[model samples]
Target: MSRLDDIIELIQTTNEVYFITAPGRVRTAYILVDDIIELSLKVFLQEKVYEQRVNCQIDLESASLVTSRNHKDSLRRYFEEKLNIDELSNELGRGTTGVPILQNHLVSFPLIRHWSANDPNARHTFDRVIDDVKPFFALPTTAPVGTPPNPATNLLDEALIRHKTRNKFYHDQNLSGLDINDEKCLSALCAMFDLVDHLFPTFSDEVKSKHTVRCQIGVLRLKQTASLGHRELSQPYEAALQLLKKGHKYDFERRSVEHSLVHTVSDRFFGSLREQFKNTIAKLQVRINKIDTMARPKQDHIDEKNDKEKLIQILQKQLDQINALLGAP
Candidate 1:
């Protein structure tokens, strides 16, 4: 199963399963999510660092890629092979903001907590960092963001609040903060999912709506293949989808509260995570296809055959890694 499916199975949302009761499922989800964000950033940066460390010409500015240290011999004692961005990520100076760090171990000599003292906008807060990456998502560009940006007007403000709450839960056994009961936990969990939606790329509302038409077209093809095509059977969904693309979404309501729940976990339920994973798989597949195309040329010599074999091995390794993540055979 995917990591998301594992989370769904492990986090019990129900109040009771037998004579006993289970609580704090959403609270656990909160903790896992907090760490996952940090881990994802580290992995993402590691790849970028590996790809650029030789020339030290990464597109993004990061202290971890301090190319100035290339000639420093003493430091080479510790980093004899190559600079490992992943190792530098654990340096005490870096916090969990998940934004690229401005002062790494070599750059600072001695760590400084207030690295953003020079510029306030560059402050390392979850609130601020999410804003930078949100554009990479399908979210409305105008969605408000700040360092603990106004909750009254900003949806992201609560993400910071949840982090504070998580800190309280994590650091204190006495549990002094607001208790993470069902209502509070569910609300916090939904907000965390909103944070996740901002972190990853997938079809936005309009994109997803356009996708709906494509999906219907796929179904229509299937029907045509089976000699069961009918125009009326397909018209209704496609028409609604076209209107949806214009921001005219329609959904039948079972109850009033259900309207508010439409965008919440109750409605979308891990959809963002699944979509992000699907996007990752699509990207890996694209890379694999390109590598295969490179290997498909005529092998006119022993050297060409050796190069082709190496490429195939590299492709197989990537596929194996992806399959392991997917729990595939």
Candidate 2:
């Protein structure tokens, strides 16, 4: 499995672990959830760093108007932005969460050769790192009323705060009095579950691949069955939705009244529709071309044209139905 697949599996396992009945499961689940949030955040940071490096190189190679000063300022944002990091022309660093023991994995590539060394005098350092435990904390000023907030765009900062609680489980002086309980544990698990769901990546997310988008939609539906409270028997409308989310993956799976509406198979339904439409349209086009090439009376030609147009219009409506079912986006 790819890294994204591994992380997604971690999220799935974390959710299952929350339901374990062991006495220490609460504390164990909390620690595991925190790890999920932190790992996702750090992975996101690494991806962003690599993407920025690639974009900068492309701009430079294409001889775009982007200047070195702009690149330098962009690098500075990494250091100033916590999970974002940089202290030199040759080094990209991350550990802004202030975890005491960290393993810094090094990547060697020509595009990011700036990280090869750091300048002693120009380095930036923080004696202490601090941040608010601010996930799902939002107060909007300009957004329309009733607009929902995006709780955790990047959870590196929030994970750091939650880490403090996790640390108390092991390292705190309050050996007997550490405030770990069902309520707090449940609340944190719910939050962490939500974060892990957000961090799951959809492959082929370029908006240009239909098969992958449908696959992603299927994956999301299965993931959300628990959160949407449809883990058991789904409501009628939700059952329909679940069917839609299942898409091509579960087409061959046995259907039950709990999740499926139809027992009939739509075997190769979309591909068949496309093939049928293409052949009909091709035949119609050939007839129209032949009529246009022939010398006929103007009145006769007009009548034939109108008849052909109506046929084409009817075929077009059928094609529209196909397009609507197989949406472009």
Single out the weakest 10-residue window by summed lDDT for candidate 1.
12-21
The TM-score obtained by model 1 is: 0.29
Q: Which pairs of residues collide in model 2?
A: 78-84, 78-85, 90-114, 90-115, 91-114, 91-115
Q: What is the alpha-carbon RMSD of candidate 2 to the true structure? A: 16.8
List TM-scores for all candidates, in order: 0.29, 0.39
Per-residue CA lDDT of candidate 1, range 1-329, in tens? 43333322222221111002134334554565455454333333333333333333332134333334432331232233333444443332333442245333234322111123223344366655444433333345576664443332244455556667778875887885545554454454344334433433331232233322222222222223223323322332233233333432434422222222222222131222223334444555565555557745544544554654554454344334333323345
Q: Please list the C-alpha lDDT of all candidates, in the order they appear.
A: 0.37, 0.45
Q: Cα deviation in Å at residue 12, candidate 1?
A: 11
For candidate 1, give the lDDT: 0.37
